[model samples]
Target: MNLVLIAMIAAMLIPMYEAWKDDNIWQKMLALASISSKAGIMTLFISVLRDDWMIGVVGAIILTVGNAGLMLLAHVIKRLDDL
Candidate 1:
């Protein structure tokens, strides 16, 4: 794997792991990671590339919300089936 890629992944995940290890840091790490995951990729290409980081940030937000909604929907469906 590329070193730069590894570095980026580390930057994004290291804080998250530290947060996971302790309750107080968990929320901050997760929130930062979630935002970073959405925005970080765009940052790599936005300057030399065509698209802006704003789109990437928006996509990330949608991804997180969509994933949570999917989980909730699945849980509700399972509950309905049980009834």
Candidate 2:
């Protein structure tokens, strides 16, 4: 299980690299979204491993809310880009 968590974390870096290697705003936004979700998943996994409901609740909130904010930001950026 720990190994799985490690692997998932390592996988999250791939998006970071892509975001860094390119200069596209949308791609960077996508990578940011991916990172957010992976972090939420990692948090959930840790919560499960520790059997802590508080951690799980925090993770659940991140999972539910994190991406919405990122997407809203992306939309704002897109709209600004059109102007």
What would you estimate as the lDDT of candidate 1? 0.56
Q: In candidate 1, what residue range of length 10 has the lowest lDDT sum?
A: 39-48
Per-residue lDDT over 1-83 for candidate 2, one digit per residue giving the tens place of the 0 to 100 score: 87898899899999999899999889999999999999999999899999999999999999999999999999999999999
Tens digit of lDDT per residue, candidate 1, span 3-78? 7556765666666666666754335535455645544453544433545667656655655665465456556766
Candidate whose lDDT is highest: 2
| Residue pairs of candidate 1 with colliding backbone atoms | none
Residue 10 lDDT in candidate 1: 64
Q: Cα lDDT of all candidates, in order?
A: 0.56, 0.93
- Where model 2 places Cα greater than 4 Å from the true spot, the runs are none
RMSD (Å) per prediction: 7.7, 1.1
